[model samples]
Target: MASKRKTSALLAVGLVAGIVSPIAPLAVAQQLTTQSTAVTHTCELVKPWGLLGAKNQGTIVSPETVVVRYPATVAPGEVFTAYVQPGAAAMRTTDGRQAGLLSYDIAFPSNSTNLAANYNGGGSGYSIPGNGPALVDRVAANGQLATEGPFARISGGATAFHGANSRNGDAVDRWKAGMQVASNTTFRFPEVALKMRAPVSLANGSTITTALKAAGQSGDSDDPTRNTIQGAEEGGWGTERTNYYFCGSSANAGSLSTTTVNSSLPRYLAKTTTRMVTSDTLLPLAARTTNLTAEVSSTEELMSNIRPGGMNFTIRHKATGQLLATVPNVTVGANGQATASYTFPTLSNGSYRDEYEVTATYAGRVDDIESSTSEPVTVSVGYNEVNANVVLTSTNGALSGGTMPVTLRAAFALPAGKPAPAGLAIQLFRNDLPHGAPITIPTGTTTANYTFPTDTLTQAQETRTYRYRAEVVPVISGVDRFVGGSATPVAAIVVGSSPGSPLPEGGQGSVALEGFFRAPQLVWDWLTGSIGQAGAFSSGFAEN
Candidate 1:
């Protein structure tokens, strides 16, 4: 009976590539060459029950079958013994009785290698002793036996379960009731593959779990009891299990339960959207002092159920809708996308408008959306033209020769309706002292007249007195031109010398020029022009 050639090779230690196939292998080598050699198998049903309960009674029952002898040359496309039921059957009885075969095997050896058998069964409740089936039926007499029959069938038909604690104490509900297999029949044993390795490669906040050990097979084995073998889990099985399931009790039966698995296997993970391409109305305008930028993008789908957490922005002012600022969360990586920036503050002259919106929240709602508004930014605040003044006329309270010249007149007030500043420049100062610089006033003039000269007079310059000042210029620009005050200080001017009619002890020619011309008037006209032609008409320049 050799039709079963099941060869599954998934050597995925890092998985490169693979494929292989060959079904029914000669109907299991002609059903082990025609059956019966003396079938006398007996062992009713021992039940002390314990796949999950009553081995010591913590309540975990389900795997309990005891027949002991049934493989004595049973041919017919022979591929002997392999049953792994349990997808729900009163969860396999516990209080309702039925729980006792934690292990089984009787001559079990038909993993097909081209039909051949020989065995005798020597026992004591059997624990191994040439096991069973083996009586020399070595093929090759007429050489024609390839019936091809069971190698793997049972498509689905073994529903028996119950595992929430019948006393195996939650090993993921006892490996989800032993890998819930509903079929099995294969020969040419020696084919087990399952691999997964990790050194470090799952970045972006990661998590991983892998544990599957059981390779090849032989005798004294260190721990190998899948009794029937099963594997395939990522999120759904028994009491919410995930992986691993094997059984062959007593030998300290343990190592092969491990649940809680998820390497991502459910499919369907789409749905995504993000925006803010560009449109705060193209934001810009305010004497052109700009720096307002905005950008946002998202689409989703990177695995691990579309994970992306971070992005929340809100800024408004579309015309008094007024929110103005709020940017929180913002992290978006794993290729989802995110970017934001805003700066626009110096626009205070005239005409302005704005509006913007962008939203993208995943796994919690608000998928992806964007908006923009802007256009109406006009500004201009500027105008300057200043003029100031202070001027006076009339001065001289008492000055007996030393210095004099204090005249003044200045005025300006342009910059209200403009007009009144044509080539203007009038700045004068003396007793009001602002000395040196500004005294132009000449183009059709706005009135600018000033004078001052000095030379050290005594008597405190006849008791002191003088004043004058003026300034204008700053039209329509940055602004800063001033001057106004001081133009009324006039007093000080008196000089005398008369009285001299008897200088006669040493007198000569008539002397009647009072005080002798006070020694001034160029010394009395230089002593009357040297006294020569002054004989007849000169009676000492009298009377006036």
Candidate 2:
């Protein structure tokens, strides 16, 4: 009795972690912020033998009471507990990033008789007499315990144990960490009852289970209230028994009840827009810009689950179905919108006719299911005007019979490897004014050709000069295509000298010298003025 009093003072506690390495305590409190769903159930064992009498037949065996508690929000370094009355197996928790192992801490008061010490092989059981509290660091195999310091080994031992025989293997399932009896009056327990923390990478909504049970049980029950305790359960304990020679027919415990307080489900929609953007005044080889924007919102306005880094978009060329770009990190604004901008390579001179599209997808957090892709937005790319050059050259430098031959060359200036411009018209200008009706020219494989009629310019009785050049007329609007260009202006002079007029110098002649040279000199001066005007006109046109 004296040794038995000392054994009553000690208690046992336990816990577990699945990983080979132990979990470290967290420095800061990292809560999940979401409400945790509770999982609870009950179990019981009874006897059917009426010879044992009512009190012994229907004994409320196993754990008389059981309660498992979980933190509202589990985080790194946080702790939870489970309460078992007298007998049971083990408890479990939902598996998540924050949940890894089950750490059990049991305290046995000194001189307390709540615990029973049983020896191996159904030997006589005894209680320790008055003695100071003693803690045994042990590893359990089957229902037997061996002394080993706490936290000395990785936690992956069996959770249910038989009192004397090694009832491991299939007997104990679905649980980790268990204990065995060392002596009739003493117990070997884990030095530290701690469940290693889970890896931080585990996502929200992950679940884990913790359970408790006795090592073995008899096949027969004496309780009239229930018979299945010792019998097999479909989809449950199966044919496994929970009975040991020292502790015969250990009973199963009661279950836990929980009512859901709220419901959590995420739903939203996403959309995007793509457009070709250009300057108001288009230029040749201008860069093309495609602006993409995405918007996301929950179908129910009451809930808002969009996070900052929860959206993305993709751009593609429609004609070739080629992917142009993908933007993965789009920050969602308070208004539930995100945007991306991309500039295409500069385009060469030609009729650009291509299409592009953009699509968006939401990258939600845990519990927030990813949203479907947004509707594709399409835009077209093409030129509104033609890019070509026109040049005018005189066939003859001098004018006779009040006529001069001039040629107009219209050539499309396009980037290398590009097809020539088609369907072009040219308008010639002389002396800074329209010289004649617009002339339509047929396009060659490369250049368009046109000829100015002879006598197109008439010289006065004296000598004069004429300035000529061709230009592209404005015909296209509300669209962008080829860029417009012009050629350098050229000039021709006509010197008028009658056959009757005699040239004289240093000596007298039939005609006066001054009168003879005066007309031609004046004509020459007028020609110079026309040349100047042509230059000024070309520069001014280019500026506009």
Candidate 3:
């Protein structure tokens, strides 16, 4: 519990990059704010699960009008607050769950400003009206609190979790409420105030807005819920980059209700430039990695102390415009640069060997510094080379009439200390034609084991000669990052005939060809085997 308190405090003051932090502790920020703006917005709430225990999702159960007071004119490089008056009459859940911990999401009107989202804003919500003291839930008092996040953001701001607020999916958070909600006349969720900062310079009339959030929303895998609010999502994000909490205990998470306050301010614009560079232009999809860096500069504005804030690196296909991957919140250093190492995923539209572009969008701590996108850098992602060899372990030196064993080995020319390829698919071929569908190479002890079956021979003058090889093939719905390899085929010769006709009369010279010594033969129906011998060939004395 003590640890959670510390974390709550850290969130308000988390952003440590250039410019003054909008999410800073209120006492430190209020001193610099001298102006304020008020905006009224009407919000709608739709919940399907009512008292009837039925699911009527997307049905608007309540409509709310919220008044927000914000800093219309802010002191450049100073932090301020957007105060929201909380108002809700009756909020209940029919899912037999008393699990509703509420919070709100703040979206600024422009990229010229920034927002800071703290879970509880270092204070608990007022379940009752402001006349009451700060309300702490009795359930949460026992340590079973609702889940809130100090999740990282791409622009260095922080936010709480908002997603499939349901019982079906266990996301990174359980979205449990700290306690059951009860109301006499009206009730309010916690943390009605949101923090925001303005650029060092800006224009006037810039506005900010927020919305009431319940559980579940649009935009996640096409999800729609009663809590869905159009154009009012918590935007700044990272893949656990701004993560500030672990999951909390819960029975079944009740719908969370949130109200984020908003304010607006503007100043003159400053010109900013962003530049990007990568370590490599040609990267193999098998090992697609590069050190990507972006630098932001401003001639008139100061660009230093970008510490906690950073840029977002987006790698996408140039031709198809399919977004591949995004490396978010790369911290900008005091040197005005942010660096990160990124790997490319397989291209979906084209072959694995496709061209990609990397772009960096800067999100600085100071709003006046101006957010900019770096010029894209192009890189090629392709497959690595794979070489193959077929080793013939055949007793039939000539493809005249005997069984032969062989193994088709496909080897990848990887660097030293790199692990060899296994589980790669290959297809056997006879005379440049596929023998069958692709087959996977089994993972051998420290190597790949690729083996083939042998064909037996009969004493009937069966004459056949064929060249067999192996070629790399698709890995059955998997993205194969190895170039197709065609193995050098082995020439198999098998010639058999009736004993009298096959012996070639009058060949006086006898050769003890490949005959293992001291093994008694047992020949039945032309299939001969010694006492403890296999795959033995003899000419002088017909033996196996």
Error of 1 at 521 (Å): 90
Scored by Cα lDDT, where does model 1 land?
A: 0.27
After superposition on all CA atoms, what RMSD does each candidate show versus the true structure?
Answer: 33.0, 22.2, 19.3
Predicted candidate 1 versus true structure: per-residue lDDT over 453-492, tens digit per residue: 3223233211122223444433222221222343332222
Task: Give candidate 3 misplaced runs (Cα > 4 Å).
Answer: 1-273, 277-293, 297-301, 304-316, 319-354, 360-375, 378-396, 399-427, 432-451, 456-465, 472-484, 493-544
Better lDDT candidate (2, 3): 3
Residue 473, candidate 2: Cα error in Å is: 2.5
Q: lDDT tens string, model 2, 1-544?
A: 0000011111111123433222332234222121111222223322122223211111122332333232223332122222211222221112110110111222221111111121111111111223212222232323234432111121123222222222222233222123322111221222222222222233444332222222133222222122112111101132121221112222222122111111121111121222222222232234456555667665212113345435677778776788978878777667677666666544435545455676778665432223546777664555444465554544443334555444444444444433343554567777788777766544333455566554345544443446666676544323434344455565554433443322222221222435433546433433554232333312111000
Name the top TM-score candidate.
Answer: 2
Error of 1 at 202 (Å): 18
State the displacement of the C-alpha of residue 180, model 2, in Å, after optimal TM-score superposition. 39
TM-score per prediction, in order, is: 0.18, 0.28, 0.28
Q: Compute the lDDT of residue 110 as modeled in candidate 1.
A: 23
**Candidate 2 — what's its lDDT?**
0.34
Candidate 2 residue runs with Cα over 4 Å from true position = 1-385, 408-412, 415-423, 441-446, 481-485, 496-544
Candidate 3 lDDT, 1-544, residue by residue in tens = 0000001111122233454333323222322121222222223322222223322221111333333444433434444554443334233433322223333232333323333443343323223223343332211111222222211111011112333221222232222222223322234333444554544544343333333332222223122222222211100121111111112211111211111222231232344678885667777666667788888876434444344557899988788898878989888877778889877766556565678889998875564445789889987877433334323222332222334333333343323333335765567676578765666654332235455444333333432334556665533222224434533344332333333322222222122322112112212211432111234323213222
